[model samples]
Target chain A: MGVVVPLEDDRGRGQNAVAQLQALVAKEMQAVNEFIRERMASDVPMVPELASHLINSGGKRLRPMLTIAASRLCGYNGTDHIKLAATVEFLHTATLLHDDVVDESDMRRGAKTARMLWGNQASVLVGDFLLGRAFKLMVETKSLRALEIIADAASVIAEGEVMQLAAAKDTGTTEDAYLRVIQAKTAALFAAATEIGAVISEKNGSEAAALESYGRNLGIAFQLVDDALDYGGRAASLGKNVGDDFREGKITLPVVLAFRRGNAEERAFWERTLQQGDRQEGDLEHAVDLMNKHAALEDTILRARHYGAIANDALAIFPDSPYRQALTDLVDFCINRNH
Target chain B: MGVVVPLEDDRGRGQNAVAQLQALVAKEMQAVNEFIRERMASDVPMVPELASHLINSGGKRLRPMLTIAASRLCGYNGTDHIKLAATVEFLHTATLLHDDVVDESDMRRGAKTARMLWGNQASVLVGDFLLGRAFKLMVETKSLRALEIIADAASVIAEGEVMQLAAAKDTGTTEDAYLRVIQAKTAALFAAATEIGAVISEKNGSEAAALESYGRNLGIAFQLVDDALDYGGRAASLGKNVGDDFREGKITLPVVLAFRRGNAEERAFWERTLQQGDRQEGDLEHAVDLMNKHAALEDTILRARHYGAIANDALAIFPDSPYRQALTDLVDFCINRNH
Candidate 1:
């Protein structure tokens, strides 16, 4: 079994939640992991090498786990969930590969990125291979609905990436635009991951809709927390250095809120630092100070908690079980986790 | 109608073949074009802009035409061929987008590439969007077999790209390696395009295999002519500067043949110019001289003609029709065209 490293202290709720989720879907996740390993193999060694470097590099496989949990929560009792869960993970992994290239990120999950090791070309091509394999797996399942959901998510994710690229470093970005970006970049796949589970389980429309809502809200909450964490002096805890978004000029929720609420002087600071990317030493500290002055980080966390509440409520329709409770606990972990 | 600009001062056979193919599938080709336009639309304008910049930039739409011609040759009457044609074109276009980024070429089809106008990131992301849309189109067809064929081709194409990258600039690369690269990078899609045509038409196994062979051979012939053109003083006619492949140190068939037949001094020249990419002034002209002395360009054309003959033989099983005649002429066009 893969090691589950919970944070230092939180009464082990995080550890218990993950362990419980793993226990519930361990078999299916194993099948998904095996499928990923087998499918990632290629005659071209770079393809598999770069793919596994990112996939096996301590990610929780949380998206696929969500897929498995949602399927079981909906009373699915078939083998196709394994295929769909793998498909979901493939799609997620593919996007991560490209995102690192696009974001020019150097680290992921506390390690150097594939792009850092292999360069952009391998990352792009291997990402394409993973996507092709994902589609192949979906074809193998022979589920048109599942195929539609996942494929639609892929397009939306691309669109979101473009939108985010266009919106980056622009301090004028609104909360609505930020939400749309995160929804497309992060939440669309999550929603699809869960909804496809419901879909493969032969769940009815209400159940599928509920699962989608749960996944979507949970995704938004997860991203909001991440956005808050970037400037909360806990970036290292998140496996990425703090102020990366600041350096990259990525105007996330905190930046958006701080920019909108700040005075003219602060607005000029944002324009110089973010819009123009004219950052200097101590700019991150000053930026965080402005966020503190406006309560941007706290407000961002509050927003995440709000979405987390909605996610928790969305699961109320389903009967209570260890699986359901584990999923519910996942929302809290997403909101409360440090690393 | 989109303009079809045959190269100037050429015998019009290439133009005639294209015209005949277009005439044979005029209505279906129109439908496929419309579908491509519609599906390529996105709320993110860059997706459509860069897509159209390449799609509408004078491509012959040959792959989609082959899909239409193949289905028609198989006596298909359904509308699914339109979708498949669009899918084939999307897959081909998507590959082109990624290829431009991978090759770092600035020009294609006599115009600046999408990467030249947008950046590498946009090209990669938009290519991905097209692939997603292509899969979505495949799912709409509800043909699991077709989906598998195309998805498998996608993986093979990516594998081919990685393989080519590995082989690039290596003077010691064998003819076998060159052929393998072209087969994956070009011919696999061609085979899938035609095979799916026969498949959707409910053609029997032999017919499907025949079309696949026909397409695969035609694609090989087409790429061989292209490789020869890169060294035959007709590179500008192909809308690229002469010696681009040489400059990029791509080990195509001509380079392989020339390297194998050259004297020791010539081999040193190849190692310095290609393997080390240490070209000086007049290197391209001297490389061309070596290619001519070794009959490398001529032999490459001879190889293309050989494949063209095989492609022709593969199509002999089908009945006589304008479509069949046009496809047969296409082989000759591929073999003889300078651009």
Candidate 2:
């Protein structure tokens, strides 16, 4: 019973949606959590410590939830999905470890990052360990198609990370490039998670494709909302500080649009702050102020809504059931959550 | 086309031995190189650039060679070994990238390391990219058992790395602990590479186990010599500067042996240099002098000979062939190589 998302206000449709989805798959999620804990243990103390610090903190566990819900929706009744769901979580956790090291991030999920406490070496190696463990678990499933899909997802995530790294602090990045980056980094795993469910359930034709589209669109919507939230002026209310993107000179969709639409003076400011990495006090406030004036944040949300709608439509092919409805609610929750 | 190991004055049995092994697998290795080049290319320029720098830096390519040679030795005539061989190389390259970053090393194979030319972040992400790519290749083989072996090897290698990190400067580390670390960190990949060769040939019985033992022993012998070479006063001739491990406060077998055999004053010196990381200008030379006095380096080579002999014996079950002869010669090459 890890806290789901840990938003300050837990009394709304957003909370109910996630709570509903998690409850629908509580038993499977238990197996997933158990698999995660047992597989994470090693003779090396830091391996477990570093993993527990991030995993046990307060993740939404949305990815594994997606795996379970989508699998159940497709009528997967075997024990292999449990292993696959745990595999999905392991892959996600591994990337987070490396991402923190690459980004030099200090905080995550309102807690100190693994790299912060265990040092970069431990973080990198343990991340590799978890990744290998994930591959081993997927292999044990003995589903070649499922393994291939997850392997492809892992490759795309790495490429997306590198693409993002190359574009970091470059204010000239376009919206298309930004979208592609998010598609690769966030959505690939999401799509794979759902697609594997349909795969393992022997529904590999239209159902797998539909679930993949659902997961993909939902992932894009999820990331767009996350990027928007950084400047939503509610960063402090969440686990991460508000305007972390601005502090890190990360050029999100809002910044990309604002930079493209800004006047010469504004463009120069963007260049100086992001490209030159010359951030000062009040810079974040002014950046948000510019975004507001240009309706960048609102537009970002609008785009998320567009993808969220597609995600909703992807689930329409399946009959109305608690599982389908819960997955549908997850899309709404992702787009509407303030945190 | 790549120079295999580039030892100075490439003459005599050691050179002939490696060259002989390489010649037996020359065509397959060419295919392996092509696959590596093709798969390493990305739309991201830095991805290829970073990979080319490390992979093309004149590595011994012994792991992949082992993959090919052992596969051929098992009378394998199929082409899946090409992909598997390339996967082995990619795995090795990925580990090297991460190792250099963790070690903060600036030099490798007498060239600037990927971490040095690019940044640690690039090295980390690119290493990740290569690792994912390796997984994709292995899955293509569709051999569940082979996939499991490689995945397990990758996991153990990571655990070994973390174990090494734990034991980095602890002079109190015993020989057994040191052997275990090397077994996980270095030998696991070697064992897996050869074992997979036997496996892909459908020789998963005694042949697989025998090849695995051969690789494991050969790898241990190879590493023992490398650690000895670091302090053998031939460091300048090698691509890496001599006493690098010493300067990094690395406690290898030589240091481990000398420390255990030292008197009180020498024991204090060992603690001061490696444990406390307080090295004076004369520290490296003094360390080597102490090692020589205690016959530590000589004993380390003697230990390597012990393993090398077992590696030699592991191949007795195989019939006489050029492949078997070349592999046998490799054990000698590993134990006797100066660089």
- Candidate 1: the clashing residue pairs are none
Best by TM-score: 2
Residue-wise C-alpha lDDT for candidate 2, range B63-83, written one tens digit per residue: 999999999999999999999
Q: After superposition, how far is residue B122 of candidate 1 from its true place, in Å?
A: 1.3
- In angstroms, how far off is B287's CA in candidate 1? 1.1
How many clashing residue pairs, candidate 2? 0
lDDT, candidate 1, B213-278, per-residue tens: 999999999998878888753222223356778888889999999999999999999999989989
Candidate 2 global CA lDDT score: 0.87
Q: Highest lDDT among the candidates is held by which one?
A: 2
Scanning candidate 2 chain A in windows of ten residues, the lowest lDDT window is A1-10
Alpha-carbon DockQ of candidate 2 = 0.72
User: What is the C-alpha local distance difference test score of candidate 1?
Assistant: 0.86
